[model samples]
Target chain A: MRSPGSRLRATITSYLLILPAGAFLSVVFLYSLARLGYISVHNGNTGLEGPAQIDAYRFIVDDPLFRQAVKHNLLLLLSVPVVTVLALTIAFVLHEGIRGWRLYRTIVFVPYMLAIPVLGTTFVYLLSLNGMLNSLLQTIGLGSLRQDWLGDPSYVLGSIATIIIYHELGFGVVLFLARLLSLPEEVDQAGRIDGCTWWQLRLRITLPQMRSVIMAFVTLELITMLSWVFAYVYSTTHGGPNFASSVLELYIFNDAFSFQAPSFAAAAAILLLAATTVLIAIQVKRTSVEVNPE
Target chain B: MHGVSKGARRGWLLALALLASAALAACGGSSDTPATSGGGTTSGGKVELTFWYWGEDDAPGANGWLASAVKAYETANPNVSITVVPQATDTFTATFATAAAAKSGPDIAAQWATGPVLTQVWNGAITAISDLVPADETKHWLNTSENTYNGKIWAMPEYLIGVPWVGNKTVLAQAGISTLPTTWPELIADCTALRAKGVTPFAFGNDTYWTTQLMLQSLSSVDDVVQASIGKKSYTAPEFADFEKGWAQMASAKCFNDDVSSVPMSKGTEQFAGGKAAMTIGTDGNVRAWAKTLGEANIMLGKWPTYGSGPLKDYYNATQSTSYFVTSWSKHQKESAAFLVFLHSAEQINAWYAATGTPPADDRFDTTKITGAIDKQLYSFNTTGPQVWLQNFFPPQVDGNGNAPAQQLVLGGQGDAAAAATTRETAAAQWRAQKPDEVKNWSNFHPGG
Candidate 1:
């Protein structure tokens, strides 16, 4: 056995080894977080002003738009988890000894490789009045079924969500597929010998194994979807046919860069960060519960 | 992992710490010197000045004229050397903000007129250019007043770009329209006739906001009420009924193609050039671009329709300067100002106009050097009754003078004319209320503000 002194020395050396990474993380991420907090609380003429302290939290909390953005974000958050689970299930099915599995995988993963701009442009084109989707509807003698996908306020969020789901599903599917493929064959064999149904095998064994990956994917998707709402809203509706699809990202951008109100934007950003943190915490709890069955 | 022994790891960590220390030292090094002088030395050696601008890949050719002018300037003043760097348009604002925060921005930078540039001025990021270009000299430039912030000129006029109604001459002739419409009703009639000929009436790319600005300008005819609201004059007026009617008509008429949301401004311009459509809203500069694409003979430039009974009978012109400002953080402000003065010289202005096929801001430049018909037409438009676009007079942040959320609303049909008018009014009120102390003459209202 290693001596206590040596063990303590090794522990100190390991921490010393990670010191650079820790410092880097502190400087880049922690420093930014601190700066964000500082800016969020202060409402001076510019962000750097010290004496003028405005309660940024109160400004955002009182606004109806902020509440709506939060609601939309929550809705988006709820949808992503469902979509990720669905993707995982589909990926599990595709990993089975099914015909044309490679083709199905390729079809699912192709959109993930495409740039956001290209996908956004293509989706906008496809949903347009004179686009292929409308043309197809007309050809099928169901012209009445076609509606203004982007123009109608009722359909805008749903259309944006659909695009987001389609865009993110590919990555989720590929990730789940990789995880599914990496499962030990003996686990499947053991489940088969026990006469467990396919669903049971997946629920009891496969999903448990994929928990960490899922947690990681969930975090990544949350961050990406949160940030990407602005680009989609900007590229398509520009936050509206009437602010219908305006989310926190776009609102913050408009407030900060467009309106020259960095303090307001900083407040919005702080809220966003808090929201994201809460979401990550929930995911972590879910992951921990999954890992520790008792 | 195999190669990294414990000693090696320790050594690596030490090296990294040293590098971090060095980086921190470097960052802290400049803080010692006072930021006012920007730590620049005027020794016997070359005095290099950095210039930043948000332009395209095509800018270098246009900037090449300016660069040659700078070289001549350098020859005259042997100690100075100027370097022009063009930044990506989308990233320029963010980059400038970051640079301003870091206090390491270029000596001189191009600023869009209106809200955005005004925001910089408000934040004390820009140096006043009153000393560089005297008020007497600036008065000669038609649009210089638009770039002035709080009675202090912040930037010198580089070029004045104005929105123009551009149409395909062949398409117009084919549609049997003898002359361009001067009023809204006539425009509708013309568009209907063009549609009857199986031609797309308006080649609007609603994917971008500027296209919407084109349509909105046509509706309101850019009167004083609109201008004042945009200029943060008054925010309570609600006299934009005509603007709403225009938007409603546009929506109902399907003036834009069904695939408009998919097409960008460049593609729309291409379609108009290729004879896929009869007319599209464009700027004088765009007319030049269209001419290059479709050959100068095919394109016709006209004014946006007049809808009001204002004294300004001329068509709506979005005349704002592509201005350059000396950064307060600039190390070589004197040298930079000298170069900008050289750029604004008559010979350089005429040369840039000749190369770009767009008229120079300088009145002294001979127009005979400009050969393109569109250029001639725009020059004539400038000479005639020119009402500067109202949005250009607003603080830069309000609309990027005409670039931001306003354009987006135009494309999306979010805010009708009344709503746009109200929004403009509200924005002005907000500005006034927010900065009552700063604004002395908030009551002095012009129609367009």
Candidate 2:
């Protein structure tokens, strides 16, 4: 062990080492958060002379579109589980050394690597009414299944969610595959020697060991669905066919940029941040308990 | 022994510091350069001016005309050099807004006709173009009221964009119709006659909601719509109901293309361009564009069919398509005004007309330059019967949030007149709440002599 003075000196050095990063965070992130909080109460469109109004918060809370946007985001959360399971299943298959697995992996991961606006635009064209998807369906004698994928309010949110899942599937697969590849081979060998079936080995050993990774991915997906879908919504439907697919971020943008009501947008942003933070906290707490029951 | 000697280490650190300094300088170089660029007089004492504009993609040959105009201006005045910044459509407004807020944008920037101009003027971001250009010259531009504020014109009108109903005469002839519709009854009959022969009467991509709103504007007085926007008249009034009923009549007649709702406005408008639909109503820009596809001889342009029969029946949905304003912070206002005046000159206006086929707002743009019959007719209508555009008068939020979607809802059969009207009123109420000052200063505009 180091002497007391030496340990103290090292401690001081560590503090000195972190000072730059701490100062940066305080100035950039914490300062912005503080400013956002300030603007959330004050009118953001006006100068300092503008009166403070808590009514901005009240207005957003009462707006039906705000409620609708929240409901749409929550509904899209359903895609998280579906995406997670589909990715894990595919990753497991790839890990089993399936034929052409490398090519398959590359093809599957391509969408995640592509820019969101490009993918969203491509999907918009493909899913449009006179687009190739519908034309192909009609050609194949599946004409009855033809629907207005983007125009119908009932299905618009679902369409956006579907696009989100399709884009995010590649990311989830890559993440799970990375973890699966790094896992020990001995556990699988031991399970096989103990007469465990393939299904049993996966369910009993592999999945249990992957609990932490799965939880982390789910938390990430949850956060993403909450905050990271503005481009898809903007480029595709523009939150329309009558505000059917309007998300919180789109609402904030419309308020701030379109309406010139930056105060209301600021308040809405705070609510979105608070809601996402609460959900993420609950997920993190649940994950920690699962990882360490003692 | 493995470590570098003390001298070598110091040398390495010095090199690292120099590299960091270079990187910092590189980053600083970009932001330090003002968006409008430095504009002090050159060593030869020539003034440098910066100009920014958007919409080259949508208005195909605008950039070419602007560049040629700049070259012409620079050649004529050897003491001046102009730099034109063509901005992307999506980021133009927001970027300008940010730059204007910082008081550090281009000396001259293109602005949309009314709402955007009004917002900028309200914020005191732009100088009145009238202050630069003479009144005699300013009086020649069309729809000056749209950008007029506080007894002065805030922007220089560039081109006139009229919303007229254009037709593919070949498509109409194929449907056994020889003449264009001129009256409300004739319009309905035409819709029926075309549909009976398995042709859509109108091609509408209802995504932008212009399909329904433009039709409504055609069927009603433009003044009523403007009054309704500013709370002087209600959308639930009898006139709007009649308009809605007329829209329902067209909807029941199946006037639109098969996949109208599913397609965007641009894609839907293609039906007419492809000769699938007999007619479509749109801005003069689209009309000029379609003229390229369906030969100039095959295209026909006319005012919307008269609904009730009044002066408004003859009025065109006319406004300055876009305008340019001198920034309040510009150091070279006089030099910038000189360039602005150069754009309105007979030579540049002719070049603008030749390149874009858009009628220049400057009356000096010779009508003899127009070769096509349809182009001449459009110019005649624009020069004679301009009317206030309802879309341009509303606050951006009101038009975006209420008008666009409510029309979509109504056309989709999900809402009625009362519901759509209520949405409009609510949007107006929101606007009023947000900008009571603008509302108090609002004055209803009437167009034409």
Candidate 3:
């Protein structure tokens, strides 16, 4: 049996090895978070010169813009399922070894490799009222399908979600495909030997095995829908056409930078961070919800 | 006089950098920065002053003029070195705010006049120009009253710009309209006349929201805007709310472009530049730009139609476009002040007008030196009377959240004037709820006093 002293020594060694990365994270992330928390309550001055209160929180609660932003974030959550299904279908098809599977894989992952700003700027022009998207629709005799893709309030958020899905699809596909390729070939052979149809086999066996990977993807995407959509929205619409596409991050940005109201922005940011923590917590404990079809 | 040509180059990297910069607004960060106005120099006696400016988008040759001016100033004062950094419209306020929080930024920075400048001053970001520049010199500066707070001028005016209704005479004649609008009823009749000829009238972009300046014609003074923002008065009142009806009427009359909400302000002006539309409201610099594009003879400049019975209704919409100010933390405040004073000298004044074709904000500049008839008219518009840029009087929050969105509501065909008024009132209440100290500061603010 391992001695208690030896175990303690090993634990200390592990901690010592982790110290650099842990310290780095604490300085970069935790420090910023603490500073953000301070800015939230404290009024703008040389720090403690002014009274610190929850005035920022009160302001955000009553702000119709803030409410609209939160609503848009919730609406974007609907895109998570659509992204997962699309990624899974693409990954599944490529894993099946279609004739151009290698080439298709390369094409699928290319967008993920492109810088997000480049994609956003390109799509903004392509989606404008007189942009190439509408022109192409006209040429293809699909003129009726052309709407004000980035202009209309009713459609702007959906358009942003669509852009994000297009950009994010490649990352999800590559991750799922990597997992599928690592699985045992014997498992598929056994399914075929049992006279299982391709569809039935995927539904009964393949999907069940993918639960862990799927969980990881869904979690990342949930966090993404919550925190990482600022670039897409800012570059394209700047949370505009009357804050129709405003997200929590953009609201924080405007409150901080544009409106000269960083106190309010800091308040919104702390709320966002707390919500993100709850998301990570849910993902970590997801083992309890795991299902076994067998 | 805000000429912001905010381009679309932002992405994840940009936002991440901004967030990182924002974190520097921490209480801990300010103490370590150049918060104190220490000496500006290296080991030698030479002084380097950094000037952050924004103008090229509105005034085409401003960058070139600045480069020449910098070179000239350096040659004249051998011991002084100047570095000029241009600012973008979208990032201007945020960049300055980030610098302000750290208490370390430019020796000299340019700002949009009045509210944008005073907001920073209230943040303790600026050193009052009255303390830096001599009274005799500052007395000659036009529109100095706009930047004055508590009887001290916080910033120096550089150039004058006015919001003029720019019409393409060729396009107007094509629509069978020879005269431009001077009153609300006449403007509506003109919109109908242009629509009958299948010409789009009153082209506007609402995403950036400055076009709402037209609504300012309904109010008499900056105090009215201040009172509404602090909840002393309702935005739903007839004086503050009535102009929204004009926007609603314009929207219903199909006065704006079909995609007004989606496009940037640049795109909205592009339609006018391309002669695809009849008229747009633009700065004096924009008037010069349009004159170049559509030929000087094809351009007509006039006041925004009289929309309300307020005393300011007939006031010409012209004022200083941007202000030059020394940072409170600037080490070379004296040298910075010297450079600002040189900007108003007769040589620099003539050079400024020659290069940019926009009027320099100095009373000493001879009006006869202005060549173009349009230039002469724009200048006259600026000097005519007490023009109210109602947007400037609004807190940045109310301008962005209330006035901006309310205009977008009408342009998108989503709401009426009443709804726009309610939106403005809600934004004012939101501001008051968030910033008690600012509310107090605004209450102390008497524009006339």
Candidate 4:
């Protein structure tokens, strides 16, 4: 309805308003991604004197450590379902106003508030051969089951995953609880009035409504399990007991910092990012298919 | 139209105010640098120097000594302001690397002797000390050859770090062994005697890879490995297999603590300190700490047991602990060099002894000044014995990532020594392939000087 001149002027003004945000994204996001890409192909050099060594990728592909790290990352993915189900169950119980729900919520959230490094360190001591856990196990006559918790390669990754789940459960519980509490009371009342059992109400009514939120959380859990487990691994296991519990991030750290081969580190990082993207895409596609049912 | 002109006048004044504010902020940021970098004004302008170091964990009183030294240096040279940054032991190298890669950091930085220092030098992060210190002065320092790269000294050597087997006389006597074993067969027999008395023979933790490194050093000579790394000798040769046999024997003999891989290096040392182990091998600083509990008279430092009666049995796996280097990016090189030289002065030398309870790297350091029973043994071992540390010869990738875990595998009974030796050779080959220049310029130190 406006004149052509005014419409053009308004469009220009709108672009101008967005210019600062666009410029910030370009520098912080796009620039960092471009730098990472360049370093992936270039040889590792602290100074700007080295030539491009595209074969850095080949070195990563041939590395046994890199392969082991990938395998560990995939193995850690198994913990995602365990964490989600535990979180959802607790969230549902709290939403139903179970006895001591407030105390339970507070207790569950306390771990998420604590720092990961400190928690991981405390757990490392607890899980050691002569630690409290083993001592208690011995006291309780379960000494036969006690093993080298952090040292044994068979149990190291699983130990780290358990620590991560303990730390992350609170965040998941609080998140799912917030969504469950926000559901309309009328819908719940209708389901109950229709003679649905508690489990049926949760399964047929409440769970169906939580599909999107659950999917979002599952996606988040997938991403975090894959990438954000470095601190726990570093502080506790150090990817040790003969690389039994090594992860992609630990490999990146060792290659980049300890080994001083940032080029190879960059290549591994890029490959991990690509793999993560593919996984996330597949998850999203599956979620979409479930939603549309086409 | 008059009202619009008045509003535009207000906008112009606001813009000018903001510009002035930003300029003032920029000036304020620049002024804060006097504390960290550029020296504050004194009689003439003072030249501020920043020195970074780490080792509070290994050497107990190092940080306190540094603080006192800085105060003394500042009082002596009023025109110089020195700030000492105490770094943590774990991430010091990585943090320094990040700063070096950015071409900016403290004027002085801490480094390990050869391997770590050479890596930084290759990256152009450090300036050669030869450019700063006089040749006459540098010639008096011990282990200068380790830091020599491309025909120049790249770092200033600090105190010696030696891993010698320290025997607990009380524990040994409990097992009916009065004499310390000097040969391989004798040591194994001693281990059997200790185990019969329900005492752990060699208390070790594989998490930090110290025990594994010691075993590796004992089994093979440094020069042989260096030659193998450079393609002059084959790592798959008979000598390399000695490592596998030695480690497999130790593991099978139950010579180590039951929780070897579970605990860290510190914990294993504690086992020896608690008198649960008859013998343990660790650095001199660690030996000193153990002496506090076990009594100086009760502990005796000796060479690692002879490995299959080789000439290298006389060689000691000793190397300098942490060294210091001036940054290539430092603007006050002359002042920094002066501070570094001042550290070697006789007054600072005494301070080093009083503070660290360890001998200084200065050759002029009088061995007679060391009077403690443990201190005397360490001094004798360092001064009289041959020097070679396996870690100093290999790159971090080969030593840390590859050899450390491979050794753990051998200790854990998952893999044999042959497999570990082969794995280590493969890692060294990768290093040689990737860093051909490093291999080409590698120095193979000899035994017995």
Candidate 5:
């Protein structure tokens, strides 16, 4: 058995190694989370910490805007699977060494590298009622498909999703491609020698190995759909056309800044944090199983 | 105010003490008295002031004017250095609230007049200008009443703005129209004629309820909006919401652009400014900006077509819409106030009008310097009437949650005027529940015509 002093020294060394990240987390994440929780229970809108109460939580839950914003965020989560499938297909095709695969990969990845505000602004213009997109559709003799992409409430969410998917697809593809390339070359050789069809080889061999990465990516994207869409909604619609495009993040911003209801904003933020943390925990559990399976 | 961080919460007890002191000062201070030694310089004999300014959205040349004004002031007073931080239109008040909650920030800041300013005053986030500025200097400041709180001037007015009804005579001529509409019935008829002529009747953007200001044309005073807001009266009442019927009618008549619900204020209004639409509502500065592009002779400046019989219906909705004030925590309160005073100097006053063509919110601004026919008429309409812009009176929550969405419903072809009114009523009820402090404090504010 290790001596008490030696055990204590090892413990101290481990903690010392993690001290920087621990301090960073304490200052940045934990502090902000704690502050958010504290602010949620207070009536700061009237005065600073007027009273600690559940009024903010109760009020936000009853708000129609909050509900609508939550619904919009849920709808955005639908894009997660669509992006994953598209990314997987592209990655598989590129993995097969299709002609000009590098160029195709570059084209797919270029969008993710572009700035969000620039993309959002360009998309807003392209998707406006009389924007370039509709004009192009009209010129291409697909005039029947022309619709107000950003202006119409029914289409605004979908337009935002399309922009997000376009931007995020590259990251997913690159991630899967990295994993695909790293898998032992001998596995592919053995599968081919066993007379496995190309589709079967990829579906049976390549797919199962990426289970953890896929789960991790999906969880990350779900979190993104929940909270990272503020920039997209803000730049394009500002949660307008009668807030048909409002998301939870935009709702929080509106309450905190525009509406002067910080308590409500904090409450909403805490709800978002709770949801994201649960998702992260689930992802951690699933990936841990993959790492140390029985 | 929003954005009270945890770091800010630690200062609440101290802030409450400061609030008590501010309340004491409000009760006892005179306009001529200097409440604190704010003009004090540091040991290095240098006074630095950070000014958070807004209104460049309404006044395009304001940024340029402020830069020149700052340079001149720094040259004249070598001991003081000033930094102008232009505030974003979307987060103007929130950023300030975050700073105020922290109890340290810009020495000077701008906020919308009355309801927005008074909320800050109650929170003890600002210093009353009457304490920092002299009675003689502020006596010349017109519309100081807009920022008055507990018998002290809480904020300083810089310029007056009115939403003037602007028409393109050339565009109107295309529809065989000679006179701009002056009544509700006439506006409908003209809209029909304009529509028949393949022209957009009134270019407006309702994306954020900015167009809802026109609904205030029916309310008589600030108290009317206040009463409706606090549930003493209903927002659904005929007098309060009747204007929305005209808007709904206008929308049904297809008087606005098809994209009215989707576009922002600048884009929708630019359709008029760029000569694509016939008429629109605009600030005096916007009126001047449009005139430059659409040609001076082609522009028609007038009041909103009459709809309500309220006392303020015929009067122009004109006042100091936004103003600057010194922050409570600023050490350079005196130097900041000094800069504000210099802004109203005769040279600066003339320069303001000349550069902006917007009438300065001071009594000393010479009116004759206004040469444009539209400018002269705008000045007369502003000065000769009771000026009450209703949007400035309501809490911003009601503006964002109630009026904006209600207007959005009608414009988007989703709901009728009654539905719109009910939306406002619901928003008001919610705000009253959320903010009882503001509602209780409103008893002290009796704004009159």
Candidate 6:
């Protein structure tokens, strides 16, 4: 056995080894957070005038365009989580020795790998007035169901939401499939032997085991959906046939670069960051329910 | 328990060490420098200057013209080298902004004459070229005053841009329309005729901001108040009502494609080129692009329709300068300014006009060498009845926020000619409310003030 001094020395050496990484994390993550906070308060000014007196935050809060964007982003945020859960459930089913599952998974996930611009263009073609969707509907004797999916403000967000869900479902499936494969077969077998139904076995054993993975996937999907509003906007309607489909990310872009107000853009970005933080905090809280369990 | 704790500590240390190495690698890696040819001195020991610009992928011929011009300028000076960096149009703004932030921006950069230049000027990113450009020379160029921001000329005029009605003669003939539309009633008549022949009346791509700007300019009447607004003056007259009326007509008529928002400018141009649509409001560059796509003989250009007789009798064509500005961060300002002056000279202007098919703004440049029919129409538009667009004259944020959003209003069934007029009036009023002191003295805010 090592002497107490030698063991203490080893502990010191390990801490020393970790010091550089700790410093790096402080800079990359903590530094960015601090910088964004400073920018949010002081506005995006470079000169020695010591931050413009303008209430940049107030401008963002009051702007109609910004409010609409926030609302749209919230809708997307709400929709993605539900979609992820459904996708994971579907993925679990396919992974359960279902026939033709490989083909099914391939067809579902193929859209996820498509370039955003290409996907946008394809969707635009599909959703156009005389597009494939409309033609198909007409041929099926459902001509009354034909509507301008892209042009109508009422349907535009729904169409975009559908695209988002479809695009992200593949990654969720792949992740859930991997997690499902890693789950201990004995735990599932025990649940089965206890006379539990397939759903009960899944809920009581498999899902519980894959809890951490599901949490991770949920966080990743939420962040991605939050940030990728620009791709969807640029591809389909450019935030509109009107402001019908604007999201906070696109709103920030239009405000800063498009409108030439970096201060305003910075303000919008801060608000978006704040919103994202709140979401992440809520998610963490919900996931950590059993963290301190007795 | 002790062993588990110790093992966890060791694992944590190892993970931290790995992360630290990654962080170091990220920071230490040299950024890939965008291509720059004039970094070192040439054989003649001349000061090399870098010029950044946006151009088409197949524009080596234009770049060749630029190279020859640079060579000519070098021969005259014998102590200067001009390096040209041609960037794709989409990457231009972001690249320039990044370069500017890094303090390694081009000595001279091409500027879009409207809000982009004004926004940069407001931010103090650009240097005033008033000292570089001769006062006499500036006066001779139409709409040169528009480039002035807060009593300083920020950019030099290169070419005057105008919205020309580009049409395929064959398409029009097929639609049985003999004469081009010259008024609102005539446009409606033309649209009706074209619709009857199962052809779309207008080829518009609302995916880009420029398309919307062109449409708005076409709808508004060329009044003094409107001109004043374009010139960034404080005017009390309500002019946008007339514009809104025109907008309503267009929207109600379904003159453009339903999928306009999805169609980019290039796609719209292609559609027009392919004779799928009768006409599109485009600039000289668009005309050139169309001429290349369609045969030169098939494409024709005409002025946007006029409204009333007398001073406003002439149809208004939107004009702007595809200008160049020297950044304040430029280390070689003298050399950069000298190059800009050389570019303004008749020889270089003529060469650029010949190569790019862009009409030269300089008076000394000859237009006779431009053989294309579209070129002739552009020259005529420049010489005859042309007016600067309102977006070109206003501050960046106002135009992007106020005018750009108004495009959606028109396209999305919420606007008309009267509503467009109201929107502009309301926008002007909002501007006045926002900056009362500045609006109170429009002359003081004028670049030439």
Interface RMSD, one decimal, each candidate: 9.8, 11.8, 13.5, 15.0, 15.2, 8.4
Q: After superposition, how far is residue A15 of candidate 5 from its true place, in Å?
A: 2.0
Give lDDT tens digits, candidate 1, residues B5-46.
446435534443333333322222222222222325456677
Candidate 2 vs candidate 6: the lDDT winner is 2
lDDT (tens digit, per residue) of candidate 3 on A47-163: 444656557787787777888898999899899999999999999999999899988988988988988888888887788887898899999999999888888888999999999
Sort the candidates on DockQ, descending order.
Answer: 3, 6, 5, 4, 2, 1
Ten-residue region with minimum lDDT total, candidate 2 chain B? B23-32
**Per-residue alpha-carbon lDDT of model 5 for A1-294, expressed as tens digits?**
999999999999999999997797566545555556666787664235656544788888898888999999999999999999999999999998999998999999999999888898888778876678988999999989988787778898999999999999999999999988888889888999999998999888878878767865786688779878888888888887778899988888877778777777777877776666565556555555564464
In model 4, the clashing pairs are B244-B417
Tell me the native contact fraction for each prediction: 0.12, 0.21, 0.31, 0.29, 0.23, 0.13
DockQ of all predictions against the true structure, Cα-based:
0.18, 0.20, 0.31, 0.22, 0.23, 0.27
TM-score of chain A of 2: 0.96
**How close to the true structure is residue B34 of candidate 3, measured as C-alpha lDDT?**
41
lDDT by residue for model 1 (A1-294), tens = 999999999999999999999899777555555555566665432345563344567766866556767766666666677678879978988989699998999998898788767787887778766667878999999999786676656676878888888878888999989888887889889999999998999998788788767876786677656645666666766655545677888767765655545666766776776665555557555655565545
List the candidates ranked by TM-score, beginning with the highest. 3, 2, 5, 4, 1, 6
Residue range A1-294, candidate 6, lDDT tens digits = 899999999999999999998898777655544444454455332212346455668856876677888888777877677777878788888988799998888887898899877888888878866578988999999999998787777888888887788788888898888778877788888888889998888777777777766776786666656655578776887787566788877776654444434455556666666565566656655555532222
Using TM-score as the measure, the top candidate is: 3
Off by over 4 Å in 2: A44-49, B1-48, B55-58, B78-81, B102-104, B212-227, B308-311, B443-449
Candidate 5: deviation at residue A36, Å?
Answer: 1.9
The true-versus-predicted C-alpha distance at residue B359 of model 2, in Å, is 1.8
lDDT tens digits, residues B333-417, model 4? 8788888888888888789889988788889887678988788878878767567666676677778765787778877777887
> Lowest lDDT 10-mer window, candidate 5 chain A?
A45-54
Model 2 iRMSD vs. native = 11.8
TM-score of each: 0.83, 0.89, 0.90, 0.88, 0.89, 0.83
**lDDT for residue B279 in candidate 4, whole number 0-100:** 89
TM-score-best of 4 and 5: 5
- Tens-digit lDDT string for candidate 4 (A40-118): 6665443243665347788778877788899999999999999999999999999989899989999999999999999
